[model samples]
Target: MDKRRVVVTGVGAVTPLGNDAETTWNNLITGVSGIGPLTRVNADDFPAKVAAEVKEFDPTDFMEKKDARKMDRFAQFAVAASIMAVKDSGLDINEENSEQVGVWIGSGIGGMETFENQYQNFLNKGYRRVSPFFVPMLIPDMAAGQVSITLGARGVNSCTVTACATGTNSIGDAFKVIQRGDALAMVTGGAEAPITNMSVAGFCANTALSTNPDPKTACRPFDADRDGFILGEGAGIVVLEELEHALARGAHIYAEIVGYGSTGDAYHITAPAPGGEGGARAMKMAINDGGLKPEEIDYINAHGTSTAYNDKFETAAIKEIFADHATRLAISSTKSMTGHLLGAAGGIEAIISVLSIKEGIIPPTINYVTSDPECDLDYVPNEARKQDVTAAMSNSLGFGGHNATIVFKKYN
Candidate 1:
C-alpha cells in the first residue's frame, strides 16, 4: 500500500525568545540570545546562574481564568500553542470533523511545580488537602489530554515520553498515524515548563547545567570553551495534515515531512553512546527513509546541546553518517541562543527547520567565538546566512540515549 504524504500546515511556538513562531523566528535569525539571569529560582543556591525562560505569557489570553488554573504551566503552554496552531491552519475542529483530528503532545517532566506543591500539601495537611486536579495536572500526558479536550478532538490522543526526545518522537509518531490513515489531521508538538526548583536542583546535582555566570555565553554550542547546556522552557506546536485533506481545505503548507528515524544508545542513562553511534544510525535511517542521499541535504538543524560530550559526539556522528557531505552542509544549532528546551527542543527545532525550507535561510549558532577541533563543520556561526535550502534535517538526542531525526523538504 502506498503511504499518504504528510505536510505541516501551521506552526506555533512559545519560546525563550518569543511567544509566537514569527516573533521567535525573527529573534532567531537576528542572532538574539534569550538566556538571562536565572530568576525563577534563586541563583545563589545553585552553580548554574542562567536560563532561557519564556517571557510575558498570559494564559488568560488563550483560556478562561478558571480553565487556565486547572492546568499546569506546561499544559497551559500546550493548549495555548495548539490553539494558535489550529487557528493558523484555518482548520475547524467542528462536531463534523472533530473526531478525525487527533492530538499528540509530550513533555520531559510534567509539572514539577505541581508535584512539589501538592506533595508538600499532602505531607503537611494530608491527602484531603491536595487539590482534586492534582493527578491530572501533574501527569506528563496532561499536555496531550488538555489539548484534545480544548480542541474537542476524539480520534487518537496520545503522548510520547522519551525524555528529551519526547517532542520530536511524538510528532514523528503522529506523522506515521496520518501516513497509515489513522487520522486526517493531527495537532502535534512538545511542551515544557522545567524552570522549577526540583528540575533545577536535579540538573544541577547531575552537573549537566552550565556554571557560567553570564547569560549571553552560557550556551555556546560547539565552542571550545563550552561547558554544558543551559536549561530552558517553552512549547512548540504544529498542525500536520494529510496532503489531500490539506489541499482540499486549501491550507498553506509550510513543508513536507518525508522521513523519521529514531534509535536508542543503550549505553548510558545520561550520556550519548561512544562517538554517537546511535545518533549516526538514526541520521542515516532518516536519509534512507526519505529516499535521499546525504549530498542532497542542504542543511542540518543539529542537536548540539552545548555539553562537552554531546557537541563532540554529535559532530562525530554527523561526519560518520554524511562523510564528506558533512563538510559541505550548512549546519547550526539554534540552541546556542534558545538554550536547551529538553523535551520541547525537538518541536521548536523542527519548526526552525521547516521555516528554513519555507524562507530559504538558515539560523545560526551564535556565540561561536572559538571552534573546537572535534567539531569541524560549517556551523553557520554567529550570523544568519541566505541559502536556498531545498531539504533540511532536524535532530533531537535525549538523555536516555533516545535519538530521533526527521527530514523536511520544501513543499513543491
Candidate 2:
C-alpha cells in the first residue's frame, strides 16, 4: 500500500511584480523590486510608508464584474490565480471527474480592507448600511470557498490558517491529501490583502514594519541595514495533480513536492524561539521526510523577513540543520524583491523554488548592501545566478511561532 505521488503541473501568481507566473518569474530573475511607496492607504498616516501591491490589476479580467464584486480582494486574487493554474494545467473539470478535484487556499488576514470599510460604514451610517457579503468576504476560508465554487471543485475543499505559513501549510496539506488518495488534482496556495488602516497601524504599533521610505531598499533581507519587514499583498497558486493523472493527461510537470514539515515554537506569540530551535526542527523534519541527505539540497528560499531576530535566528537554524552544508547551498530571499507577502509569501516562494528547479536558475536577494555577522551565508545577492538546482527547499516562519518547510525536487 504505497502512498500516491503528487507533482506540480501548473503555477500561477498575482503579485506586485506581475499578474501572472511568467511575468513575475521574469522580474524576479532580472532582480526587479516590485515594492513601492504605499499608495492604497494614505502614506501620511503611518510611519512605515511602503508596500508591495499588485499593480494595474483588473478583477474583471479574471472574473465577471458582478461575481468579483461579492468577493474580497484576497479572494479575488485567489480565484484569478486558481483559474490561471487550472487553465495552465489544461485540466478539464467536467462532471465526470469534477468531484475528484479540490481547492485549499489560505490567508493570514483576509479582507482587512473590507473589514475596515464595512466597519466605517457601520459607524457612519448604520448596521443596515453594511453589505451582507461582509462576513463571507472577511473570513480567511473564503479564498478556498470562492475558488471551489468558481472552479467547480467538489473534493475536500479546505483552508489552512497558519499566519505567515498559511501558504506553505496549505500546499503541504494539499500534497498530503493527494498523496493519501483523497483527490486526483488540487488547486492550492495562499492569498492576502492586508494593507489597511488597522493593519498598518497594528504592525506600526508593534514596530514590525520597515521604516525605510525608499521601497527599493526597504526590504533588505539578510542585510545588516534591514530594520523590519515591509507589508505586501497578492496571491500564489499551483495546480497539483496525482503523478499518474498528470502523466496520463500529458501535463507539464514543473516540479515534485517530496517533503513537508511543520512545527510550533510554543515559546512566544510573535517572536521565534531562542536560536530558532523550532525552525531547525521543521527543517530537519522536511529533509528527513524527503529521504535526502542535507548535502543534497542545492538551494534554500529563506524566510528572511528582514527583521533583526528572524534574520539572525533563521541563519542559526539553517546552520544547525544543514551543518557543514550551510555554506555550500545557495540561499536567497525573494522578499528582498517582493516584500513580505505575509501568508502568501510561502506560496509565491514555493512557486519560485519549483521554477528554479525547472529552469536551472536561482533568483537573487536584492538590496544586500551590507553584511550581517550573525547572518553569514551565500545569499545569491544582487543578481540571479544560473545554477542547475537539483533540489530546493522553501521555509516559512509565521507569527505565533509557526514554522513550515516544503521540499521540491527536479522531476527526473
lDDT of 1 by residue, 1-412 (tens): 9999999999999999999999999999999999999998888889999999999999998999999889999999899889999999999899999888999899999988799999999999999999999999999999999999889999799999888888889899999999999999999989999998889999999999999999988899999999999999999999999999999989999999998999999999999999999999999988998889999899999999999999999999999998988899999999998989888899999999999999988999999999899998999999999999999999999988999999999887
Which candidate's lDDT is highest? 2
Clash totals for all models, in order? 0, 0
With a 3 Å backbone cut-off (N, CA, C), the pairs that clash in candidate 1 are: none
Model 1, residue 237: distance off in Å is 0.6
Position 293, candidate 1: lDDT: 92
lDDT of each: 0.93, 0.93
Quote the positional error of residue 209 for candidate 2 in Å: 0.5
Cα lDDT of model 2 by residue, 1-412, tens digit:
7878889998989999999999999999999999999999899999998999899999999889999999999999999999999998899998999889999899999989889999999999999999999999899999999999998899999989999999999999999999999899999999999988899999999999999999888999999999999899999999999999999989999999999999999999999999999999999999998889899999999999999999999999999988899999999999988888988988999999999999999999999999999999999999999999999999999999999999999887
Q: Evaluate residue 212 in candidate 1 and report its C-alpha lDDT on the 0 to 100 scale.
A: 91
